[model samples]
Target: MTNIAELRKQINYHLYRYYALDDPIISDAEFDQLMQTLRDLEAQNPELITPDSPTQRVGAEPLESFDKVTHVVAMTSLANAFNDEDMRNWLGRIERRLPTWYPRDAVEFVVEPKIDGLAVAIVYEQGLLKQGATRGNGLVGENITANVRTIKSVPLRIPATPDGPPPPTRIEIRGEVYMPIKEFNRYNQQQLDLGERVFANPRNAAAGSLRQLDSRETASRPLAMFGYGVGYIEGAELQTHWDALEYLKAVGFPVNPDIIRTKNFDEVLEFIRQWMDKRDELGYDADGAVIKINDLTLQKYLGLVGNAPRWAIAYKFPAREATTKLLEIRCNVGRTGQVTPYAVLEAVNIGGVTVRQATLHNFEDLAKKDIRPGDTVLLKRAGDVIPQVVKPILEARAADSMPYQPPTHCPDCHEALSHFGEEVALFCINAACPAQLVRQLEYFVSRPALNIEGFGVKISEQVAQAGLIHDVADIYTLTKTQLLSLEGFAEKKADKILAMIDESKHQPFDRVLTGLGIRYVGSVVAAFIAHAFADIQALQQATQPELEQINGIGPRIAESIVDWFSRPANRTLVQKLRQAGVTLSSSKVEPTAPQTLANLTFVITGTLPTWGREEAAAFIQDHGGKVTGTVSKKTDYLVAGEAAGSKLEKAQTLNIPIIDEAGLKKLATE
Candidate 1:
């Protein structure tokens, strides 16, 4: 009597809308309430749970060749230990043997949500991230170093320990990289808008995104990773997984904060139960719980069994799976120079929001799902943010399904794109291209740029189209009527814009330099450049010899600086800017005294008592001391302030001198 067919159809339609469309009509709480009711009904009547039901299993055929990778140290998957009885039995088995296995010395167990994603091993040599690979049966994996490099959270260069020792001379770290629900949603939405196929869930999305042939593509997807275990470390020592996570964070990798250390197995169960109930709140999909012996030494004693690690276990969450059609495939380009591919869905609703799109990452992704524009696909939402396409239903594919193509040119600017030999991004190198110019102009006129209030993108475009302003400096000379004539610019708005332009003249010399769109010249570098040269004219006239003396300005940036100034048009543009009354001089005096805080590197910790961090740093730089972020033996002093955290302990451990507000003031005077 249960109308399973009708209910299945209704649920499928709603799922498609939520996961594919991104526009949802129902509240998450309401949707979950309905889903719970349906699940309970299905459980009561097992015959009613159909393949098409929302509670169905995640579908995807296994892949063929995961490129063979030899981990510096083998990357192993964790063995499973589910439920209280299973956990206690394993703990007894471990305690029955090992010499260092006393209950009190057991320390606390580290419990984390078993993030459902691909396992990868990252190797760092001498504090530099060198390689990353997947766990292909634990002993070997496919090298994905390049793709892993695209993850911004993964530090390219590890921060040196405060104790004057670099990070382990050789270290192999194991972790899981995942896609957050919010980023996945945005990624899928972008794909949907571009008419691409969508990903089904967070796990699939993360796996598919990470395995990309083009690491660059893998890098662009909203993929995040957390270091959960260590494979091998030389020189440096960590006692527990919690400490390892902290160390990873210190070295610039983002670690999940939800990881907890509990003294008892009941506490672990409570943590799991609590998290399972609150699973929808996590940004990434967690299938189960990952329970590990917190102590690294304990982990070593209980080491490898087959392809799994004996020290840890994964308790996966109940799976939520759904099937939908892969309507189309598309690509998106962001402001930060990343091109992401996504899928346009047949309008599914997963979680509370309607999903119409899912990200594909790049050209390399198209091959992974074997995803064609018109194929039926299965999907799942891990933490309810990203919709990942699992695999194409080959048997269900329409005859018209075809492979997707990558664009040869920049969609925003018609310029021919060029890919750097070292990078996967095909850059539109023409800085003067309409789109790049427009973006740069927008940035230049931003509060941090020229600080012109009324000069927004649309206004800038109007000016560009009208041929009134070709360069950033031209914005300073626009007539009030010229702006007033544009679509949204009224007399008052135009006057306001003009006044903002006038105000921009007073922006510091460093801000003006940054607004010029010099390659690799950000705000901090701009400040350095301003301080390096006494004025704009001096910077322009300075030889490479003089320019190379500034710290952080390497050969490439130095070359770029010289080339920028050498261009006749650029010189003429500067002259025009000067004519327009832009200030290109700094008021700060250069300290010429020997040993006046010279060569003394200081690290600023937490919020300053009386000054903004930057202001405090500027105070140090003005007095000839360099301000760095982390504590190190190279650091002359640690300026500790209110709410100081790990860096404080690091300074203490390394015996680096710690200074307070009064001490900083004294140093400045000395």
Candidate 2:
């Protein structure tokens, strides 16, 4: 019998890591695989099924730091719909079980973003919060009252706003405690700066923060709530799930604004399809969306299938994380001659793409992860961002596999590789390295650089491999005859390339500086250097101390700038660009708006009406204000917008002045 007990034990152990510890060793897909195996076994051998089997529970047992409370209404899980066919099957099952008299129009469904977070049930006595607990094993849960009180969005009292109606005598509100994506990244960076261990994801951060032994520690973490549905209600009569959600929000729970309610099942599928592509924009990580029967009566009648509600199903998005065997490791040199490690995997599919290669980040990250060939590795792939090897599955490593030894020489040019002071990446530094030139040429003509159109990495590679261009400056020196000699270069294409290369000379000095492929001198930092130095000669002559005086230019960046200018070859390239008539100097432009925000600090969050987050931040900086990531007492104003999440709450709690996009414009122009 394949020892079904061992499978159960393994599932239970992983459940504890996922729920109680908030530090899962295996990926979610791996956990699901184990669970599915156990489920299949139990289905085949019904006599071997036990009540304590992981398949029979809602969640793991809560940590011992808090007291346990049993739920009146069990906090059950939902069956998952992974695809359109799976969802249709679920709908068919539900329709078959429902009363024949009920029309399709009468059945409405509510879809809520399934926040990747910790599920907790908050109990209220009259209008005040009485107790809060985790969804521990569905029936019993931990008493996390203190930590629950720390989350600003939880509403310590019902009807959190003044004009709302009186609350239910007793209500058990259920919501996911989550850290927003932006907040989680900022928090991780802050923790890293303080030499603390960073979390693997936002869900872990939220769960770990909530389970913190100290409530004060929990308070410092940027956490928020998104109420999905009520578990148990005493004094209210909610006929539908949509009405319940409305009542929960009306009585002051924070519900996600992007939820949809529809009578058509096609619309439900369409909603999930649309959200699958846009879940990143939600600010919080939502692995899927929860689809529930709107009618409370239908839910009650069709409830309970193992541990999940038959009336509800989770429309899971495509898996972004997967476990795959790492076959080999390769190195690629970037535009600045920085060599980085990447994994050549045994081809795993993540987010609907077959990822044969994944990033190892740098040699330092590769070393820290202890990744070796012939080991099973955890891989993560977000949209457009290249797939990355998160870590190696140490237990699955081959006994004879050795530690990865970085190459002593550049793979492309076969030249000795070296690293600069305090830098992680090994550098090629050979100006004529074929791979290095291709990347440099590509970056030189990018939108943030010289803004050259009709020139991309492919074209850069074609020109480089054909020996038509040696450096970025050589692009400006190329004639239509040389361009048309390359493959895929028609007369029109060749003319466009020549025209764009000529047009690139008109780009501001900052763009020219950025296009130089200098380490740490991105478009923004290049702008500061250009405005301060006015010309390439002045910048090259400037001292390290002078570069450091610029607001955004730090010691590391200054050192890189000084070192780049010190190189003889780099100076030669600068002269070549100057001879090509590329602008190497420009007069600074005056800001259209006055420095009304002088001496003030601002922090912008979420989606604004007229501007993106970075655009808003730049606007503030242009008007003489400092922009920071976190909300603190030092913040003069918080430029908040829709879906602002925890930062907005933190600013409000700190009594920092809050302003909208319009208000920010007013402040800048005042």
Candidate 3:
């Protein structure tokens, strides 16, 4: 005989703590246990189920189509301001239109981040969330009440608290439904692991998640919201925009804490600058800052202009995304002989930088995106990160455009391209290929591989073109006289380059393994293989079964290892490295530790205080724990850090134990 009402109230309180306040007293597993108990009681007593109940958020059936919702007051967009000058011009227009009694300097503005998400309007009747709809046009939108109910931050029924006003007769709250960057990354990683099509960015992920026909699918996505303004309200006498925000917050609506009210335009500018610098530090993506008149009276006086309000302006930061025509698709052979596709764009400006080229990842990704040459594609660049093609604008694509076919031969050396088992990328197997030689040399001297300074791409290309270096092994045989023959090789520069190359001979065997750029052997795998084998000779002699016995080395990686070692050229290259006096084994070696967490699978999320994710995962693996990307029923524990997102939520829902950095350390010692 479970009290269903009490259980719903308790679950809702925990939801508010976890979602709205970012603090939870009990662990996720404990919360889920309580939820399960409530769910069981509801299942036994179906007559007691209500629309506002926590269990009623996700429906069993999928919707065929969304019903249209007509807004009482039109949801208009804001006019843009690219610079301070544009903002001043907008302010000037507002000042001129306002009544003469209103003071220019005294006009207050409510400034908030313009979240890069889908705009939605939620209607509340008697403090119960009645309807939710997208801003499809200005007037009519598709009803998404069933999906919106699944969002934990959105209150299903507003309850009166000590310092808050009672429920209003009717109210319309407008907000941006967004996916946080952390959650977006987790979701994308899961998609990649599952070999599914991943979303290009957080905005796309949120939009797709919210528009799902199945409410259960929507419930699975980590969607949150922050109320910005109102469409209409009844039985509420809000005098100013700030007051309206406060009232909305008081009535259990989530409003951004960063929202500020300032009369001085200088303060507004400062706010904009601060946010522009720290936008990435935020959990969610914000494209710009929205400035609106604080006074409801002044807003009415200013009125509407075209489709936007004259009293409000959106001061956008530099463009992070834009549309451009993909002129052509080209392939480049990497040091590892992997062929990658790239897009040549019709020079588009993104974030004040001209983006002429962007990576298509690989042929599989290129095909998955189906971006054909002559298509208008969405280009995105985040901060200093490399620009990439998000996807093609299908509606704007040429009618006669066909699917792109990958080249059968290497674009640079004309060697036949071939793919290994289960690999998505095509590889050029010619070790002596001129393009491969240059790329391989560049990789061998790279910071992560050999830590050689002054041996950049340009230098590597020059040395290769001069025939002074034919392979990675040839780099050690270069003479001072031969280097001086090159155009930019002065006495001091040549000596420095030689010294850096000399210093790299003492690098550990693991680095040498990584420097070789063997397929499926990255820094982590190299470390594992180095620890397992006594030296390079022992590793080369190891069989496929021996390689597969090591944890994390699957059948594919084992096959790659055996195949690489079996090659006559690769074996000769290893002998050349040894003859050059390079280190072939680890200096400090210890016996393997006890396998305390042998059967456990851990999923790590967020930022740990002293350990990075990779470092923490390494420690876990060393102590015999398996680290995975996604959280599931098989997950033993979730290693949570600051601002853990969807993984934490899913872990909690699945009743998996959640541990902090300290707890993980304790587990390692135990």
Candidate 4:
């Protein structure tokens, strides 16, 4: 192979490992270095860069509108099974249609998650991605090739694993493109902070992200694909559904890892039952589990019942909804000072949980829904999200009830509220708003923030309401006797809380910044700002341009930081925190540790004997070494302990040195 071709192959292999398989044998820096080299090589020899090159996934020119795609094989739907009986009925139908030669007991089934996402069909020609489209009308769909190309999980070239299955001449794969629930939440909050309208759920977020006209916009979203089945193929024949999924996985597609192939019907139901209860644990949202006849030939024989396939069925989870009376409309002032509306509902059971309240989302959504007190509202509890008011039963509204109004003032402080530019959320701009401060206090002690152990939310609210603490900074100045005077505080509990508060004062500046509850400044973003600015004084003095220049510090975060520091009351609070002996700079003012492992890079995996992963990473950084997520040839050492899985194996493969916790400490102190 030519040098350029081999280089591109190597890059594609690493990309497959990193994106498709979620395992990497290279550090991010090494991967970046490889990409940079390829970019330079392509610049030197422009014609060498093909459309399937790793460098060519993004930067497609924007189209006025998406083109249409007519499917060679229709993207058919599946009938749904709400319970075991429904699933049994489907199996019975399949049994009745089965040829006499094919025994019913010999039938095998493949059960996979029915991802609550956008259904898409992607085509491949000569192992390279040809085109991708949304499942528009079964036989026809919108061409979203440009947008799909940007999804890293959707491989540009097939057979991601070396020496895997050879490419088919042409193949059509069907999959669901989805956003992880956690990523969706974070992305939605970021959008809201940037004054953009946010998606109500992960499924909507994935769909909206995948359908963006600009490919770069799609690239920026965290979209992933899981191949479920095949629509059409030439030069390849698959006999079983399980084999098809396996073939898809071998050829660079990420299939659902939880797919189970079983001959027993009871096993299928058991898998579905387990998944229903554990739905929240799946990183991505799934509305149901799909059961398919494993034999492909049998599927073809027992096919086409209306728009749905007769051989497959979706076992949908019970819907989480209940009709509850809207007792009242309430407003809550959040830490960022956004006053959001919520519903005070009469106690109703939704999905086994007695939900007393539901999120109205924001004032704009409330106005759009026209939900009023005394109306019966349909509540939906989706996984871990706060139960939401889907819609009100307009016919069930009381004659005396009037349309609910969004709060005109801050609910707690009665301060005048205002809209932020074109944003829908109303903000209480009062710096000393008591309700906002209580939320700030609650957040300041959260596990991801300062981590004031034993300092619970109820106590934070109690102290704030009792006039013991005015702001988060005042937490450091709280007296033991004052805490003991509270409802739940005993002498022992009060002392422990005081000690935790003192310990929190020693928390790094990033944690302190996170605890401050600045708008758009999440813990991860706060860390970037803290590292870039070094000290509270430097951060306070940083202009919008200076803050925005830092990596990952966006305009919204920069503006929020600048606006936060501009307030005199906030400045005074910072001074109070500093006076209370909080470490405000990047690190404590002290002598530096020995730079023993200055030039070294390390990878940590599994449970360490004497140190946790974070602790070991901190120790390495204390002596000036870098720690990365993956093992690579460039990695100086692998700090490993019991059950160090793939990273250990990769390190061994590359002949990289391995060290235990003791050896790691020894090297750090050398």
Candidate 5:
């Protein structure tokens, strides 16, 4: 039998690789096998399970409230330097405070991106994570150890590597916890698809995700950390700030790889300029560049002025906001019947981009902001993406302005708008509403759905306006002659679009399900439903409870699925799609081969070399295996590929066997 301690060490190392370094040596399935063995051993010998074991990352109950924790060393804020003049002035101030022995111009400094996130201090005692707290008021914070442990990048135990330095008696690692931009966008999209309020920006999303009372919820969120500095340290001798960062990295903390050490302030200025132009390229949000004195002794000598450090300054990028007057507020109904309120703004230049309109998010947010017509509003364009109205400048509000009211009728179709139970936004529930039909057609041809080439938002709108395509099924009825009649539809373009539309008929049933625009049934959920039922007919016949029994399908999603199929129009559309020769079932027919993986469960993650996750999962199911979204003791294998995240970590910790595409193929043959 494998030693439990050795298994734990191996799992932690792989986690550090997958999370901290963004690299993994083994597939998820192989890792799960290791975890399962360890779990079996620990289950049989309960005393062998330790706090630092990987299994302890999750499974904590929700807390009613957090307890206050006082910091040994205050997590101070940094002084701001907006320009070269400000930087020079700050350097001069630091020089004046330094002793004569320290050469002012020769002092080394470290420059790193100032992450826009929540600051938290992680305390490690005897090499294990002891406590984690937020930097509330800089002096004291709420203890969030359980939630922090759920962050895969944050190691539960320090000195995780065998060759690493001995355990520190105690240390407080201070870092910013943030959600990567990609993950934030994905999460916000999920929220929108579910008819929930979306986060305004990544920073807000990170803060909200971190402060969840349920650690399980936090674990579900894609949160990561980058250690920048230490709050307190005992037992270790750190000579300089750079040395401390190196020590943190050696002990399994992820430090930003873009950090640079330089003695020249000119280089620092250049670095800041480069980052200002390239910050969007980074995975996480960065609002500024932090320049700190590299020497620990010099930092101590030039320490605290008020609450900010004298030896360090943050060179903030110019604000991406512009003040504009709210001309009016209007609502737009989406294909899914979701109604969103937006602000019509007097044109203002934000980050060199002209902003004519901004999103107000929803009616609830609009009422909360108390924004009215003729009020001055702050509009921000973070990363030059979508522009959003921050808030109304109450002082600049028109004296006669009244509180804005949500529309009682659909903006486009003029039908009565209705709000769903427990939902914030109003919806235009009429399926035949022209606006809804147009948007729904657009979604049907979207990349994640049927992926009809040459079919874009403008094209979908034109086709709908011409009465060529009213519903997703009507798309197959379009003729090249009808397309050529529309503006901008030449012979070549029309022919190409017709060909693409024909090509989409072969799109798998899962994507067809997604293209149906069922509420809360995005690609992930659609795939689960498609796999569970094998065919659209089976899915349509499934009861709400039967749908909910699928791993990823919750009560709300199951209800949505059942409600959608219950409608006569939807059933007819599915029938039309089938009549049009569209694939309405799994492409892989039930295999006659021996059920090699019978009664076994597998979880798939990341991108495979030759097959997509869905393709690989379909193969497993065809061979009599079950696929689930999460890894657990019940999971027999985890099919992992490149860039696997939390699932990979969890599999490794549980000692579950992991396999790659090749390994999976081998298992299928056996």
Candidate 6:
């Protein structure tokens, strides 16, 4: 029989060291090999797979719902310091308080970059990741274990030695959840293509993604995290925050190396200044620096007051702010016809980048902010959000400064602008505006859209300028030879573009709808519309009330659809697309037969051993069963997989049916 107890104990200790100590000495492959061995051993000796074993971290039980967990020690928000004087005052307070508590001659403070992201806690029992939760109100948070498991940096099981001592029985690590700039950019682009409103910054994106009701959706986005503090621990003792971070790294968690232990306040100040100048160079966004007392005992003595800890204080850099003169304001007609205003600024540094221009949203926003050329404006580049003018420096404004006025015609096609009855934006009605055509063509060939492989920004512009492609429909008319003649494109690349365009013709109707760049009609909504209306003509004729009946769609979405279809130019573009031979209707003329599952409803919990959650949901949906979000009396079945939670109990309470994958397969087949 496998020494399951021994393996569990050893793995638990290493996990504590890695996640809490950040002092991993072993390679990731070596750690994985050990875990695999333990898993294999447990497989052979089934009885040895205890609930606390590493092998049982994620198992066959499905969750009916997650139980709310309250924190023993509440997570607190930090106080902000906006300027140098604020920083000095904060340091003085700490220095004044330090002598009264400790006998040391000089106080040492550890300064680390303050990550601007969502705060979360991960709990492990005997070295296996058991639960993950958001920092909701500091006292209690929503459990998000499934989504946390998807983060690659978070270790699934703590490492163990063949004969090493057992790991800590319990431990909790706290960290910031954030998206890197590159990932944030890609995600926003995807959202924009799908017609969803873009996130203002990475912090907002991380928070929103983490709080998603569906863990599967949260896992789909590129989210990363770093452990910074220990929330709770047993079996091992840690003296300092830095030590805890080192132990965390030792097992397998990724810890920020930028955290430095300094003996003097001046050094801490220097580190803060250095990071401020190089903030953009870092992989993640840092709004400020956190300074903490090194001794854990001293920290406890200082205790908490309200939401902040007296032992720790955040020294925020002056917001990545700059003042610049707006030389000119111009409107750019977007592919969807919204006239967006942009300010040409006298170059200034904001968020470590030289910003020369910033978006003003729309003409309505310009009037709302009362922005104008020749006025000094405060600017900021918030995470991966666009550089924007935060406000005008009223005191800095010259006497001659005047409010900016929006243009009466489209800058690209010179078409007269017209406003919607209730909307703030003035839109250009021209379908063939050069700028609009170029933007649409670019969006069409983008990887997520039609994914025309070799078509790039320059090539798309050239094609439009040559009148070879006026709309997405015109891409089908281009031959490989004609594409090869374009500047900088080679024969091989041209062949790829043509092939991609050909492949795009077979794209599903939902994708086609999204590529149309309809206002307020994003990817999810488009899919919902396609599934409901079935055909282009049916969708075009859908009344506002009919469209509003769908679960996710609202009155605004219905109005946008009505407005899009009502336009003569938009209707012409649709005809052009139809002429290009793109499939304009759902191919599913007859719905798939309802497989004895028409009225059944299922709620899934935990990780399925054989198939992904999406695959399982697809199986349920295909057989005419509905996959509901939560467990309730209406649910006919609760599919329990590994790592099941409170959802399982709720099912039992309501007397709802529960089944495993094997049972589900049987039901589907029957």
lDDT of 2 by residue, 1-670 (tens): 4589777766755654443334579998898788866765665566887644555432233345788889988988888889999999999998888887677668888988888899999988887778889998999988888788767566666665445568889988999999988888878644432223456678878999998767767877988888888887888788888988888767657778788999889999898989898865778888898999999988888878999999999988987999999988998877767677788999877766788998776677788889998889999864344577888988888899899999889999999999766655588879899998998888789889998887988999988998887878888788888887888889998888788888889999999998897877878788777655546886797678666655578897888889988888789899999999888865332356576876687777766899976577667666656566667777889998775667788999999999999999987777
lDDT of 2 at 173: 90
Q: What is the lDDT of residue 110 in candidate 4?
A: 92
Which of candidates 1 and 2 reaches a greater TM-score?
2
Over the full model, what C-alpha lDDT does candidate 6 score relative to the true structure?
0.75
Per-residue CA lDDT of candidate 6, range 1-670, in tens?
A: 3366776666765554554345666767777766866765664456666655555434233356656879877888887776667777876776676656476545667888998998899988887788889888889987888767766456666643333334588989899999888888888766544334456578878988777666666766778888899997898999888788777766556678789998776777789899988887787878888888888887887777677988888877667778889888887766676677788999988655789998775566678889878888988886556787878888988899877777888898898988767766677768888888988888777765666776778888999887787677778889877777778778888877777787888887877887787776767787776655545776787678666655467898888888889987778777877887776765553356455565687877766789765567667666665565567766799998875667788899999888988888889888
Off by over 4 Å in 3: 160-163, 321-378, 383-386, 390-403, 407-670
Cα lDDT computed for each candidate against the true fold: 0.69, 0.79, 0.82, 0.84, 0.86, 0.75
Candidate 3 contains a number of clashing pairs equal to 0
Q: What are the TM-scores, per candidate, against the unseen true structure?
A: 0.49, 0.54, 0.57, 0.78, 0.84, 0.60
lDDT of 6 at 417: 85
lDDT, candidate 4, 506-546, per-residue tens: 88989989888777787888877665554688679777866
lDDT of 5: 0.86
Count clashing residue pairs in model 2.
0
Winner on TM-score (3 vs 4): 4
lDDT of 1 at 48: 61
Ranking by lDDT: 5, 4, 3, 2, 6, 1
Backbone clashes in each candidate structure, one number apiece? 59, 0, 0, 0, 20, 33
TM-score of model 6 (CA atoms): 0.60
Candidate 1: residue 609 Cα off by (Å): 29
Per-residue lDDT tens digits for candidate 3, residues 273-317, read 899888877788888899999999889988899989988999998
User: In model 5, what lDDT does residue 156 have?
Assistant: 90
TM-score of 2: 0.54
When 3 and 6 are scored with lDDT, the better candidate is 3
